[model samples]
Target: MDPVGYSHDEKGVSKEPQHVISEGDHGADTELRRLLSTRHLTMIALGSSIGMGLWLGSGESLSSGGPAGIFIGYVLAGSMIWSVSHSIGEMAVMYPLPSAFVQWTGKFVDPSAAFALGWAYWFSYCITIANELQGIVTVLSFWTDKVPVAAWITIFLVVIVLINVCAVSVFGEVEVIASSIKFGWIFVVIISMIVISAGGAPNHEAVGFRYWNSSPFTHGFKGFLNVLPTCIFAMSGSENSGLVAAETANPRKSVPRAIGSIWLRLSLFYLLGSLMVTINVSPYNPDIFGGSGTNASPFVIAYREAGLQPLAHIMNAVIFISVLSTGSISGYGGSRTTMGLAHLGMAPRQFARADKTGRPWLGLLVTLVLGGGLAYLNVNNSASNVFTWFSNLTSLFTLFGWGMICFSHIRMRYTWKLQGRDVAELPWKSWTYPYAAWWGLIWCMVLMVVEFYLAVWPLGKPSSAKTFFANYVSVIAILVLYFGARLYYRGPWWVDASTIDLDAHRRFYADKDPEAKKTGFKAKTSKTLGFIFN
Candidate 1:
């Protein structure tokens, strides 16, 4: 087989001139189309992060850690997410592909790490798919309790599956619209919060830092540390932009922009929103801990407390839309991760198959079955317990994924130096470099340790050993997969820096290639916005 030419398909037929499957060449011939635009990419990243977690789950964080604690936790977590995004963005733009960082782990570090991270990430998304589906039921119950939870879950599962099985363009467009709605709604809510805080509501009572001073820390520093898991879960999907890089148009330009905007989005929607919640809704408010469902959302509680019952209902509806958008994006992420795994020969070849529209039907179908089953299981459990279980399962996997991205970036830069590759040749680079990557890696490890401690010895609460294992099971499972891959594959513990393939499968365009030139106001505007945002 030619290293840079056509390779045999599963049928042993040389169908097309595809780059050989090697370091950077994994999934080079994937049928997934590059139909997503800059807007789609940006919205997907933004929409994925601003979901039910922000709307409803923040209540849990606020309840666990008081206003000051929650704010501090998000600031710390936001910085770590930013570092991870930069590290992943630099590599995704350089070699844009599905599950870019996962493949990079294999190329720059070790196949075992890639295998572990890929499966860990896939599992995380699948769990999120179920969590979001269950979330729909919880959100709907806010308006009425007439519908059975099982029916709601089934309906949502079908709708999400349909979206994932459609053309990639349809998914991109849906995400664009959904994400835009979420972005606009957040600003509206933030402004409303500001009004409420400043005595603009019917009650006309100013709530300036009252909650912060009265209950700055719940259960002291331990309570503040306890909320870290919820905060981490809220920020989990911010990196989905990199997963879409393979299917994004002008990814070298678009991906970096999408990744760069993460901090801004996090600050506006998460950090500032937390401030708004703390100001408008007291930590001691019973509604802040309204068990499960959308009723517990700080946005809803704050509005209702301000004597605006109608606005609370409206916010509850918006939470439903937010969760639906999240479910759709989770489906997309899970299917793509599955396809990436299959592309690397870790999963069955059929799992990598796609239809005419470049939709990964087989992988999507498999994910739907698993995710739907989990959602169905939740139908029998209390919504609060279901949310807690899923959240616990998902919390650690993201930290592990971020750790891998930072580690991989460190190794990639080392290899680039060893190969004498010019940094100027890179499309995007992380300004923070060694420090940013190291900071992300070390803190992620610290958070994981803290998470384990909270699981066993929760502050001001009691938990059993069984509960502890359940919470940390994903971590244990990934460890098993990592060592299992290492033993089975018996590849080098780490690839040599000089032997790393940095150039293969790069999406290069000639000066005369039709896409190389920009025309029209829309194109130029898009480019400018991407540059500014990224």
Candidate 2:
């Protein structure tokens, strides 16, 4: 299929074609509808990243790493995420393919790398769906245990599945709304924490740096190292914008703008939230480590500490919605990755079929059904433990997925230079040639090492075989996939730069597409938040 075609309206604004998917169209190359605008791209990217990772996982980080440890760990993770975004953002602008990085690695690096990373990334998000479903059950338990865990899982699973099966426009709108709510709630949490920190709450007790002074590092360096995996998990979904590049109407503008704003979200939402949580609540609070849901969230705990129980209830509700939103994103990412695998001939072709609305119905069904089935694992075992295990395993996949992304960027850049391509001719370029990508790649490697050490010698318990495999299983799976693909394809370990087809699937924004010239309320709103959405 050709790239999504656009036509200009009477007002000179770009409009998407209303072409419905043909019933006979079952090819892997069917083009997705370019209904997602710049605003949709920005909002969905933010929405996807600000889920259970920040709301619930931060509590685990606080318990293990103390206030200072979580803050510093997020800072480090934020930096690495910045690099990954730029690295992929630059490439997405050039290729603008569905599941951009998976295709990029195969095109610029090696087909085997793409096969391995594609499946690994798909599994990570698939497990994320299960994890978030479990998270929903845990958050609901904060209110009452009257509803059975399976009941809540079924309800939300159906809701998320509905969202995924609809048109990309509907998916984009739902994400935009969810992201707007999350964005507003984050500010409320931050402002309330500031007030509570300054002795402005009902108790009139100032929690000014008390936790930091008392226990900055709960277990010292080992504890700080322990927080890295949690940080990795929390920062995992920032790449969703790049994944939907094909569906985005103006990737040349929207992809970079969407990724360019990650730093702002990281600083304002993640880093600031981490700092506030550290100040407002003591890391020693038993609740910090008790639950795997909102009850343990630093934001909720902060409000509870400030004697604002009602707001804590509201926070829990918001986080519950946030988890569901994350589940929606997980389905979106996982299905697209499945479609990408099929397109690359790495998976069965039937999975690539899209429905009338350009929804990858077969892939979406597989992702949600399997993911929802996995959610049942919590019914018998401890929900919290299952959540933790799933999170740790996914984090390991995130490490490899992100590392390969940056590595692909490095290879792409070297190939571009070797081909004597003019940097100015490219639509977008990474912030720093090679350096940022290198930093991101090295950070992922270091975190994997940290994960390995923790897997062998956990913070307190005796190293067990279960713990080791739990952490390293994703790494082992990726290696197996890589080698399996290698044996089947028999391609070079690293793709030759000279032989790379840089022009294959590369999108050039010239006179044909007028999407960048769009004007409307959404574009104006984007301009108002220009610092981020520009």
Candidate 3:
């Protein structure tokens, strides 16, 4: 057998990869079903990324980084994400394999790297689940403190788990509906911001560029760098589009289309949203710093400050929904990643178990039990504090995951050249070859160093051992996983690019028709809406 677990016959035809699960438990349909349509892929890409990181945590970003700091930070982060999307899209279109990055790292890089990255990446999603749950507790407090935080956490936890453990079609439909609601709410918020900036509020005060003018940058260059972590948090899940390729009906078409649209989503939703927040809300507002619920949201703060009290309430409710949408996405991402780890034999075989409906129920249960359970930390610590802890950890892990993606892409490209393969043979090619990959990898390292600086001296706070270790624990965890896997597996630190089995699990052999089948008005409508829902 090859190092990646697939063997080839004398004729060079690839055999099926070895399975970790036993035959008795491997009932019919062991793989996730390709039931998700292009619509589902597009919406998941858009919705999974629009979460508490923007709605509530942006307030903390503004408080620490100020208006210009965050706006610039997001711009840089957006570019880095663009590179990552393209790099992953190229590979996903060709492989269309389960556990997208995990498999890629194992095949193209090294098995040890795959084992380490797989677990860390899964834990990142888990942390995101916990972060969103904590956001829900904070958002709900806007309406009533009479209800216990634990009650709301439990209610939403059950709801998300159910959504994830069902057939993926159910999960896809739910995401489309939830994503639509989030899109509408964000549109309303952006338009409201524009109107309010132009003195449309009852107070008739044009706050045009007032916040930016007062203090565009906070805490200087360090403050701008500090904002990068929150930017990573906000844009963390765009790569999940590639992760779902194996579950998509037509990954060659849908995955590239979805990945290609990431730039537009980042530009419209995240970039514009952050810009509006900066223009409408003052960074120095006491309420924007360390409060709970909608009171801490810059959007809600801007509305209330403009005397638009009712709008503030409506915004908070929408934010509550946004939290649920993201929490559900986190669950989906976590379960799938855990299942991928199991398939790679990096985890227990039971984690790979799926029901007849093709739901990874056991993995979903584990994610809910471990990841969802972290939400209860709000019972002891303040919701904002817990949010900060998870966000910091998640953001660091995201950087590492993205960096590895770029590194893997670089290694794959080198191997492709050594194998005498033509770039034209690829189903989808990255927009800019080695440059995009290098750009992403370089920025990831730069930001990792920035995180270290902030860990030592947090924004607007004195340096403390507690703060430093808390911020770096995520980094330490990944290093531990990587070295531990190396010690156990006793494999080469890095696989030789020349020896990589590039053809393993590759979905395409001889090229077929590049054009997709168009049916009727529905297909035409889908094609017409390709700009958004491709």
Q: State the displacement of the C-alpha of residue 137, model 1, in Å, after optimal TM-score superposition.
A: 1.6
Candidate 2 per-residue lDDT, tens place, 340-434, comes to 77767777877677776778887888889989999999899776578678888989989888898899898888898999998887788776768
Off by over 4 Å in 3: 1-30, 289-294, 509-534
Q: In angstroms, how far off is 38's CA in candidate 3?
A: 0.6
TM-score of each: 0.91, 0.91, 0.92
Task: Indicate the residue-level lDDT of 176 in model 2.
Answer: 88
Worst 10 residues of 2 by lDDT: 19-28
Candidate 1 structure quality by residue, lDDT tens digits, 11-102: 55322243433222223567677777777888888888777677777887788788999899889989999899888888887667676777
lDDT of 2: 0.81
Find the candidate with the highest lDDT and give its number: 2
Instruction: Report how far off residue 369 is in candidate 1 (Å).
Output: 1.2
lDDT of 1 at 31: 69
Residue pairs with backbone atoms closer than 3 Å in model 3 (clashes): none
Models ranked on lDDT: 2, 3, 1
RMSD of 2: 7.1
- The lDDT of each candidate is 0.79, 0.81, 0.80
